[model samples]
Target: MGKKDKKKEKDVGKEIVKDKKKKSKVVKSEDGIPIITAASAIILIGIAIYGYTVYQDLAQVPEMPELDLNVWWGQNTTEPQDTSIRPYRIVFSDAMESEIRWLFEMYRRPNKKKSFEDTAWNYGVHSEAFAQFFSYWIFKYSFIQRPKFLNKFDHFKTNIQGLDIHYIHVKPNVDANTKVLPLLLLHGWPGSVREFYEAIPLLTTKREGYDFVFEVIVPSLPGFVFSEAPARRGLSPHQMAIIMRNLMHRIGHKQYYVQGGDFGHAVGSNIATIFPNDVLGFHTNLPVNFSKLAYLTWVFGSVWPTFVAGEHVDKLYPFADKVKFLLEEFGYMHLQSTKPDTVGIALQDSPAGLAAYVLDKFMIFTDPANKNDPEGGVQKYFTYDKLLDNIMLHWISGSIATSMRLYKECIADAEVEQVFSQIPTPVPTWGLRFKHELAHSPDFVLKWKYPNLVGTTNVDFGGHFAAFERPEEFSSDVFKAVKAFLSFKK
Candidate 1:
């Protein structure tokens, strides 16, 4: 009876094992390879579609146009080449002076309560400070003397792209045989060729140790001062670079060095990007753009401060504080970028308003601490006469509104990021970081964006207006950069 029961149990187990094997085979045949193949095919198709879409977008972007040197003010002039660099002068008319006086006397000041907090500038120019500046503009400042002061530099104008470009072309007081290097100096917004007044002497003067002397050319950017505004819209920094390059070429400088700050930084960078062959070297007081590698390195640098920041660890790390400061300061940029016409109209009509607007930058950008003072500490660094002269250039020329339009045109352009990203500046570059710069960028970050960055100089003094604040230091740095470039080329 036991033997028969054991035999039956063994046969039942064998039957159960066979049934399990048959079910496993059916499951693999039905779903395994086909399901995997379908998922893999779907992923491949998605990748291919994304790749094609990006390729299409990149293909549609327009390339920058070549500059037309022959088209002078859109008229075919058979005039000789010698007359191209015509002598120019600034003449402040009686009508302009009368209007400026009336506007200053009739200005209606806004009611602003004094704040014990350091955020007074958060509300814009201090009313009392603006009042004082307006008083100097109306009564004390001499408009007649401005032209004489400006004429001290060799002023000239050349028609380029249907607009008259005004620039101060000063050569070193040397013999014809002397090899003087051409250096283009570009000024930023709320500033004119006046900014380089102090730096000009320093650059042109032949110092003992410095091997090269500069033939300084400081141009009032298009839509600033005497330079005519763009007839059409969309004159971005890149377009301005084209005009500037053409101006250099017309001046008989095939290859030249460039130095700039603020908006000038953008223009100079674009010049180096688009026409690297023409730019011998580029230097800037303010350098923009932070690559992905910079961000990652910044994070790691936060942990090991000495590796990336060195002595400037405080300036580079604690990112939250820097971001907070930028949020407070970037309000003007927002207004100018979106609807410049709103404030531009106010600035155009009222001389007092224009003075307040431009002088506010002079006060704060010179040193943020100046915001706390009653007169904005403007007189601490800059003379009232000098500041008023700069304003007169804008007022007499009626270029304030058009000059502000650059922010609108460049920022609103859809291809701004694409154009900036695609262009890599292979030319040698140097950066100067002043203590109170709008944003203090470390050397590591500069190297990330500028592949051929030769050096970076950090100074304790000066802010956004480094060239104006410390001309000696600025000129010395320029000399260093030029020397470095010459060395690198060898």
Candidate 2:
């Protein structure tokens, strides 16, 4: 019996040895050549894809034209008085050119921390890029007309709500058959009328079988970009609404649709509320929820123990996640709201810093679902090139400090609860809520009064900067909403 047991143990040992050899062989085979080869192939493929995208981008970027453009600086309207009723030709003076050159240099300088270097933060980075692009026409070549059209944009000064306001008006080529909607586009802070360059094609042109066209009017917000800064304190949102209404009247847009995002959203909402009869309807990509804060308070207070115990999962539905997002993302707003000039002056001087500041928000907020990140976390939602384009506008215009003050002023007068609860808009409204638009989720939005909401397009594509990132999708949604308005009328 002992001899038989010894033989059995030996047989078991042999089996174990055979199994180990098999496992070893399999591991060796996977690691030896195939895995390394596959990884190398993947890297090569990624490089190829990146190269192609870069090529495509380079190919598409339009060139700057040499049309003797002007940079008129200082107090009031400075332009060559139009004898031919043509565009007022303005050229940058030597001093102005030097200032711009300095601006670009400040942006490109190396960061305090090498690892923390932000591409967008670089000064003059945007201006240099755009100016370079503008200087040489790419194959697509239509945008060279921008500088040419610059002179055509009529600049005017008017005092509205005790603040001197400035604006640009571009009338459509009126003809016997030309029928266009009067469209008023407002710019948010850290941006100007320049942000609409990409979207202008869709905004103001005649599409085939689409009889609809637009007499596009883009404006610099009060105390932002080229618009006159407020002389006094307490420039209420409601007061701004009055100013916008008057501006529209001045531009001959008696009844027009209003579109806005960010601070533009507040302005548009206010316009709709103040002058419902004049403003036809309102549309916004950045849908705000007045009820979100109230709902969050209620939910948190009700489930105090669950929240305290770190088991509050239900609130993640919309309201809670929004709060978390606000905490995580809005540090810039907090600082700017309190001390605009502080950050503004620093960013104004450091183009790189401004680029980083603006670019980070555009990247994170636009598409929290980072398609570029292989690890499946939000690295950046926007393309670097597009991000650069927006920042360039700020840099070229030299309006970084002026832009930040909009936030500082708005926040000081911000009675969120009062504004949200008190205002009731009768104008037809539509909201295109992107996936990552925090408090703008459907569940959360439904908690508020969407009295004027004609349609809500819950887009599967894009994030905060939907207009730029997913232009086709964004345009389609915009047209659809407009159709909804028309459909109801018919």
Candidate 3:
């Protein structure tokens, strides 16, 4: 016989031997003939136990919550007791718009002062107060206002973990699937769930047979915007991970994928690590190296000095670079993380200050070359609607103080720790690198934070807000990573 035939015959012989042994061990009492009844009973019991195990494995998947998408598209006029609106409509009249235009024209006509810091403090104080006040007013108005832009999806209000989370869900028209892969998206500081609004349509669209239909969940970080702010202190990113995992389990998605950028990167990573069995994978724009020894070697070798020296053009970012980035890019972090109560007063009182403080991030976060090009930077990185939308969430929620406090709470215990330590994640990971992204390189990414990075792609287009700025590139790269992760099974 051929090798295949011989192997098949050997497997059959083994099966026969096993069955004969089981039959020979059957307990027969006073019966003259050997009792086959005892052997049959033993076989039945084994079959029943095996069936139950298979049933349990199939039963673990959670169900999707029934949500009404229309409520999100409708007007929201309800005013909560804790919040107040600032009167912006009273201050900047339509006539002021025309006059400011003429005033700027006259001011730029000839030689102007190179810089102005004479009343810097006074100006800053006034700006923050005005921003805080106006943010609330504009936000409330927009909440009830009609949306001019057209999109395929609708928004909804869902209560998760006793807190209200505003989310958006989309389903494709051409090839709708009853069940879809769940994708949870998380945003970082100075940003809200509004960041992914533009990419929702592109994400929900199908891609031939490989269409991994996604039921996307985008929740604002607690206290950041719409989500309820916790009154107690000491809620770290790890705690948030627990809440997210629970939310996933409660929502019937025991297995799901996650994506994050900025502060959300930490939360996403934490979720993957603490709940690896339940998580399918995790993706982040920011990946850091965990090994302190490796970092020190690079620092001593002089290859990782740009980040240390505060230069924006850094090749290998180290812990020192992270510190520098925080010191510079995070003025808000200082105020909110350190003395939340003191700064919250200024942001809550002044609308202009809030606008300047919040808008400043947009100015710095965009490509440096496009700083002066106002039309391009904000629009390119995030849409005009999204920027205004996110800012409005902060304004309307009146949680600026509470949100800033979260930074302080999360970092309180590890104030002086050099490296972040957490559980190892079994989830597959994907990293996207944009050319103009603030501080990211493959070497830096692998060295600083993310250790289990399975795929990293460098894209030619986009900047900080990769998903919003360049949807086509962002979606394609995201889908590619999804394919790679789906194919990898441990």
**lDDT per residue as tens, model 1, 1-490:** 6999999999999999999987755553254555556767899999999988866544333455454534443334466544377899888888877777777656645554654455555567776666677666767787777778878988999877767889999989976655689999999988888888989999998887766789999999988999988777777787788889989988899999999898898889888878889999999998655333445566676677777777876666676676666687667878888888888888889887788788888888778777767667778888888788888888889888888988888776636634553445688999988887775556656654567888888878888887887889999999999989988861
- lDDT per prediction? 0.79, 0.58, 0.59
- On lDDT, the candidate that comes out on top is 1
Give candidate 2's error at residue 234 in angstroms.
1.6
RMSD of candidates 1 onward, in order: 7.0, 20.7, 21.1
Q: Model 3: C-alpha RMSD to truth?
A: 21.1
Question: Better model by TM-score, 1 or 2?
Answer: 1
| Candidate 2 to native Cα RMSD, angstroms | 20.7
**Candidate 2: count of backbone clashes, pairs at least 3 residues apart or interchain:** 25
- Give the range where candidate 1 is weakest over 10 consecutive residues by summed lDDT: 68-77
For candidate 2, write residues 1-490 as lDDT tens digits: 6999999999999999999987765553444765556777899999999988855432232222222112212234454333221122323345644675566565445453332123332221233333333333222322334335443456555554444455666566646585778777766655566556567667665666555767777777777654556655555454566677777776667899888776677777777766678877677887665543434444565456344223322323444565676786778888877887788788777655676577546656665433233322222343434445455556655667767776666767665424443444667778877766544434334324446678777655566666665666666666666656655541
Provide the lowest-lDDT 10-residue window in model 3: 82-91
The best-first sequence of candidates by TM-score reads 1, 2, 3
- Judged by lDDT against the true structure, how good is candidate 2? 0.58
Q: TM-scores of all models?
A: 0.81, 0.65, 0.64
Clashes of 1: 0
Return the lDDT, model 3, position 400: 75
Ranking by lDDT: 1, 3, 2
